[model samples]
Target: MIKRRLNVLLIEDHFIEIMKFKKTVSFAEIQHSITEAKDGAEAFKILEDKSRMPDLILLDLNMPKMSGVEFLSILKNSEELRHIPTVILTTSDNQKDLEECYRLGISGYILKPLKYKDYATKIEAVLNYWSLNELKKY
Candidate 1:
């Protein structure tokens, strides 16, 4: 088993999907930690903590209290968490959502109900291809 190195934050409300994702993105090989928050409010708390701050965040667009868009807006506007890259991991395929996310400066987005067969590969690609410095200039 690969030891978790990076602490990944997942801000998804769906319990089943979250559980599935946790299992799919294994500690083996990938070697990254996983943290889940049911809502944007909780995610904000995680981001607020300098120690709990994750290298990456997997966010969902539709949620209770604070939506992904709302959270992104706040984070982008916050001096402390603005630099952290957040990837929208939602089922919304709407162009508007996509456009808004890009405008808000998200690192990337991944659709859910992920096929077990290809989920790991896609995640690996996302993690492997992720570049914080390149994202800053965008």
Candidate 2:
């Protein structure tokens, strides 16, 4: 299967986590465009530009300014943004958080694994699936 190069928006707060994700992508040798946002507020600013919207969003539940749930709520409510596929990439294994994310119409929810290899594998699978799957273009 031909792997499509995806435009991805990664909404995360921790600098180390961000670097880890970038390193994974680089190590995996996946040619993808990744946009980073420190928090929901920053993500919102980036999302405002419809012309440059990402194909997929990887959101972290814990963030400053606005939590992932809060961000998801607003995004899901917006007709213009609701269709974009958002997958939660979080360490929280709380059932409530998982249920809430699904209730808010998240595309997928994945817990960050402790091991770097495990994390990389999960990320690779996610990117592969989304890249191969058909997405709605607005």
Q: Report the C-alpha lDDT of model 2 over 1-138, residue by residue, as the tens digit.
A: 777888999999999999999998886556889999999999999999988899999999999999999999999999999999999999999999999999999999999999999999999999989999888776
Q: TM-scores of all models?
A: 0.84, 0.97
Relative to the true structure, candidate 2 reaches a TM of 0.97
Task: List per-candidate RMSD values in Å.
Answer: 4.1, 0.9
Model 2 stretches with alpha carbons more than 4 Å out? none
Clashes of each: 1, 0
Top model number, lDDT: 2
Indicate the worst ten consecutive residues by lDDT in candidate 2.
Answer: 23-32
